[model samples]
Target chain A: MNNDILVTQEIGSFRKPQYLSSVFRKTSGPELSRLKEKATLETLELFNRAGLDNIGVAGEMYRWEMYEHVAASLEGIEFFGPVRSFDNRYYRKGSVVSEIKRKNSFHDDELTFIMNNAARKIKLPITGPYTMADWSFNEHYKDKRELALAFADILNEEIRHLYGIWSKSKSEVFEVQIDEPAATTHPSEMDLVVESVNRSIEGIHGCEFSIHVCYSTDYRMLFEKGSELKLHGYNLEFANRDTNELGTGSEHRKAFAELKDYWDIDNTKFIGIGVTDVHVDYIEPIQLIEDRIRYAIDAIQDPAMIRVNPDCGLRTRSRDVGYAKLKNMVDAVKQIRKEY
Target chain B: MVKIRSIEYGLYPRSEHVRLSISKWERNALDHKSLGKLMDAEKKEILKLFNKSGINFYTDPLINWQDILRMVASLSLDTPFEKISRYRETNTFYRQPLVESYPRLGEIREEESTPDSHLPGSMYVSDNSDHYMYFLPGIESFVSMSFLSPELNRERVMDSFLEIYLDLIKKHGMKRILLFEPYPDSHFYEGNWDIFGSAQVFYVRYGLTEGSFSERKDSGPFSLIASNEKEFDVAARHSEVPGIALMNSQNTYLENPEKLRKSATKMSSSLKLDEIFVTHTEYFDFLPHVIANKKVEILGKVGD
Candidate 1:
C-alpha cells in the first residue's frame, strides 16, 4: 500500500470487542486496563490486516463516547442520564457545575500504549472544545463561548501532555484529529468553533492537526469559515448523505460537491474524504468506494490532498462489517493509486 | 402577588422499564402487545404524578412517540417521510417528512378520514376529565425539519399545513395546543404570529436568544423557557406571554425547590399579567425517568 498517493486511515473509532465492551464500565483498575489493552491490540491487528496506513488510536478502545470520556475526566462536570443521539444509541450528557479543570489525562495512556506497540502511524482523535461545550449544559460559564474557550484551555493542556508522550518515542510529526461533530450545527456559532478549535492547538508545535466533523446539514458555514481554523486538514463525513450509485459525475456524487466549495475557499488543507457509510452494514463495494474517492480527487484536483476514510466511526457497525468496510476502502485506495 | 398556575407540555422521558421494553421489542424479544402494556403503565404513572402534583392542565407523556414531529407526520400527512434528521440541535433525531409539493387540506382530510381516526388514541384525555394540552410542531418548525422539493413554493406549503392543523384542532375539540419551535434564537416569522393569534395556541420556544436576550415586543400567546437565572431574568422582563416555564428539564440536576420558588416568586412579581404558568423548560425526554419524576415533584413545590 503506497502512502504517497492517498493515505487510508481509520478516522475515529472502531467497534470494541465484545469482551471489553460488555464490561467496559463494570471493571476498573488493572482489570479494566488489561481488557482495554487487549481490545486495542486486537483492533490494531484488524486495521493492520485491512491495510490501513494510519490507525487512529486503535479504534479509540480506551474510551467510550467522546463527550462523556473527556467530561468524566475533568473536574466540575456531572453526568446526567443517557440521552439518545440517533436511533437507539445513547450517550450520557454532562453539565458544567463550576470551574472546569483537568482532573486527569484523557489520552496519555492510550497514546503511550499505541506508540510502544503499534507498527503503523497513529492519529489521536480528541473531542474538540466546541463539541464538548455544545454537548454539555453550560451552568457555570457566562456563555457557551466562554465555556468552549475554557474547554479549549483544558484540551490544550491534555494535547500538550499527549504531544510530550508521542515526541519522546518518535520524531515523526504526531497527528491530532479534533473530532467536532457539532461544528456546523449552529450557523451563528462558526466563529466560536474557529476560535475554540484554534485555541485547542494554539501552542502545540510539530503536529499535523485536522478536524473531523460528521453529519453536518450544511457544511457551507464550516467551509466558508474553516480558513480561520489553525488546522492542516479536515476529515468530514459525506457518504451518509451521498448515493451508492457508481458514477463520478456531480449528480451521482452530489455530497462531494461541497468538496469544491471547500477547495474554492481554501485548498491548502488536506481533506480526509469519507468513502464509506459507517451507520449501515452494507459494505460499500470496492468500485463504489473508488468512484467516491475519484469524485473527491477530481474536485480537489490533487490526489495527495485527499485521504480515504469511513464516514465517521465504525463503532456503530459490528467488527465483521467494520473490517469489511475498511478492507474495501483500503482496496479502493490501492486501485486509485495505480492510476496516479 | 400574581396567581401562579403549573402545567407541562412535551414528551416526557421513558422509564427504564419502557426503554428496555422498546429495545426488546426492536430485537423481537418482546411482542408489540407487551410493549404497549408497558408504555401504558408508564403513561398512567406519569398522569398520576401530574394529578398528585396539582398540575391540572397536563399533556400526555408521549412515551411511545419517537419525537415530536414523527407521530404528527405519520398520523396527519399523506406525504411520505424519508430519512431521519437531527431534531433541532438536540441529540435526538426524527424521521423528516419529504414535502414534494404543497399539500392540499383535502389530502389531510382524506388521510385522516375522520378526525378521531387520525389522532393517536393514547394522546387524547378522557371526555369527562379536565382538558390536556396537545403538542404539535409549528408550521415554521415543520417546514424547517422537512425536506421540501426545490420546485415547490415553501410559503404555500406552510399556509396549507397551518390550515390543516387548524382544521384538525377544530374537529378534534383540542382546547389548548403547544406549538413547539425549539430554535436557538427567538426570531420567528411575524406572519405566522398573526395567524396563531386567532387560536388557543401557545408558541413554546426553547434556547431563546443565546447571548443577549432581546425584548420581544408583543410575543403573542407564547411560553418562553428559561433554564437559568440569567435567562429567567431576561424572560421575565421581555416575555409578554402569559406563562414562562422555569428550570431546564433536559438537565438531570435536581434543582433546589427553595431556590426555584424564590426565582418564580421574583419572576411572578415583575410580570404584569394577572396569572402566569410555571413549568419546566424543554421536554423531559432528555432526562432519565427517575430524575424526571423528581423534577416534576420539584416543579409542584415551586408552583406552590
Candidate 2:
C-alpha cells in the first residue's frame, strides 16, 4: 500500500466549551462579544492540543448553526416567530421570510475572529446553496432550481470576500467545504445541485473546493459530475452508519465495501473517510481507528488519496467527548504513519 | 350530477418505512421477504388512516419510493445495466434522468421496455384501498421519453407518461394518474395535451407554500396541501381548484390549528370553495377536524 496518504482535519463545528454555555443567553452587548472571542481562542487551542493537521475554524463559537450562520450573514432575510430545529437542543433558528439577498459578502466578525485566533490555515465550512434553499421555507423564488442558483450567487460573493481575507494570511490551500445535506433528498435535482455548487466556486482559485455530506449519499453521482465541478475531495459519513464494522474483512463491512466500489470506478477525487462516529458519545479506541483507516486503505487500494476525519460535526457531543475523539484520531494517525 | 371530486396525493413518512427497514436490510438483519411484509403492514396502516380521515382519492403509500428512479428505469428503459438505474447520494440520495446518464441519449427506445400489460401486484395499496386509488410516477420517468431519439422535443417527455397512462387504462381500467412533480416549473407540460384533455391529471406537489399557490392562469388549480391557516388562506384566494388541508399528523412540521382558527374562519366566510378535502393519510387513528365553514360544501376528499 502507498504510504503517502495523510490523515488530517476535523469535519467542522466542535462542541461548545462549557464555560460559555451559561453566557449564551445574552443576545448582544460587550459580554457576548467577549464570550465569543474567548470561545474562539479556546476552540483554536483545542485544535492545537488535539494535533489536527488541517485545523478547522470552529463556526459554532459564534453560536449559530450551519444554515443559520449563512442566513445571518445575508440581507433581506426576515426572522419570524417560528423557529426550526433538527434535534430541538443545540440549535433553533428563526424561520425565514422574504427573498434572501446578499447584503454583505461574509460575516466579517467571524472572519476577523478566525484570522486573529487561528494558529494555522483553516478549513472554512460554508453551507452550500442546495442545502440553504432546501432547509428554508421559500418566500421569494419561483422554482426550487432558481432559488438554489440565486443562493449560489450569494455564496459566490461570500467566497470572493473570503478569498480576499485569506489571501492576506498566506494560506495557499484554503479548503472551502460546502455542506449540502439536502442534495440526496432531492435526487432528480442532482444536476442543478452540482451546477449551483460549481457556480458558487467559480473563479475561486487557490482554494480547494470540497463538498461535505453528513449522511450517506450518491457519492458516485458527485464523482460522475466531478469533472465539471472540479471538486478536490469528498468528506463523507461512514462510521455512524456502521459503528460495529471495523477492519478489512468483517462480515458486516458494508461501509468500506461501498467506498471501495466507488474508488474502483472513480479514484480521482480525494476521499476523507470518517473514522469516528459523532452522533454517539463513545470515544473510539485508537486501535479501532487504526483498523478502520487500514481497512479503508485496503478497500480503496490507494493510501495516497485517503484522509481521516469524523463522520460529521461533533457539535451535539459534549466538549470532553469531542476532544477525546479528536485526540484518539490524531494518535491513531500518528501510529499508522510510524508503521508505514 | 355531483362532480366526481377528491384530493389525490401520496405520503411517504421517513420514520415509518424507508429509514426504518432499509437501514436494517442493509445490515442484513431483515431479509427481503420480511422487508416486504413490513412495508405491506405500513401501507395497510397508511390506507386505514386515509379511509378514516374521509379522503376519497389518494395515491398508494410507497415506503421506498425514493428508489423510484431505479424502479422506473428498470421498468421504462431498455438499458441492460441495473447499476445505471441505482439510487446514489453523498449527503442525500436521488436519481438522475436516463438522459443525463446515457451519452447516446437520442438513440434509445424507452417504449420497448413498456410492459405489454400493467405490472400485476405492482401497487398493493391501489389493489386494496376502498377509495379512488391512484398510482404515482416521478417526473424523471417522463423525461425518459426525451432519450428515445435525437430530435425529441422536451414535450415528448410528458407524452411518454401519457402512453403509460393509456396502457394502464386499457389493462386495469385505471381512472386517474397522479404525477409526483416536486418542481413543476422546471419541465415542459405542453406534450401532456391528450392526457390533460381527456383524463383527470392530478399534479401532486408534496409540500405546499404560498409561492407555489400562484394567481397565474397557467398555474393549474392547486389541490393545496396546507398544514396551517396561512396556507389555507393562500389556497382559498389563489385556488382555481379545490384545496387539501393537510392535518398536522401527516406532516413533520408542527403548527397550531388553534392559532390558524382566526384566519381559517375569516377565509371561510369570504372565499367560495367548490370543494374542500381534509386529508391526513399517514396516521391510522387520525380523524381530520373540519377547519373551514362556508356556503359551499366542505367534503372529505372522498369517503368517511
Best by lDDT: 1
Residue by residue across B1-304, what tens digits does model 1's lDDT show?
6666666777777666666666676666766556666666677777888778766457777766666765566555566465566776665666677788676544232223221122222543422346367777766777788888889887777778777776666666665666677643334344445444444555565555544433333434455545444555555545454456666776666788777666666766765555566777777777766677888787776664
Evaluated at residue A5, the lDDT of candidate 2 is: 60
Clashing pairs in 1: none
Interface DockQ of candidate 1: 0.25
Runs of candidate 1 with Cα error greater than 4 angstroms are: B76-81, B99-128, B149-173, B183-200, B205-241, B250-272, B288-291, B302-304
Displacement of residue A309 (Cα, Å) in model 2 is 0.8
Task: Quote model 2's TM-score for chain B.
Answer: 0.56
Q: Compared to the true structure, candidate 1 yields what TM-score?
A: 0.84
TM-score of each: 0.84, 0.57
lDDT of 2 by residue, B1-304 (tens): 1122434354343332434455466456766556556666666665665555555666665543433333344445454221112122212223344442322212222222121211112343554444654655545444542233445555554555556545554555555555554334433444343443343444444445656533334333334444444556565555444344444332123344433333333445556553454444222111111111110012242322
Residue A328 displacement (Å), model 1? 2.6
Tens digits of per-residue lDDT, candidate 1, A43-118, equal 9999999999999889999998788899999999986577766445678788789999999998888989988889
Each prediction's DockQ against the real complex: 0.25, 0.03
Model 1 residue A233 CA deviation in Å: 1.1
DockQ of 2: 0.03
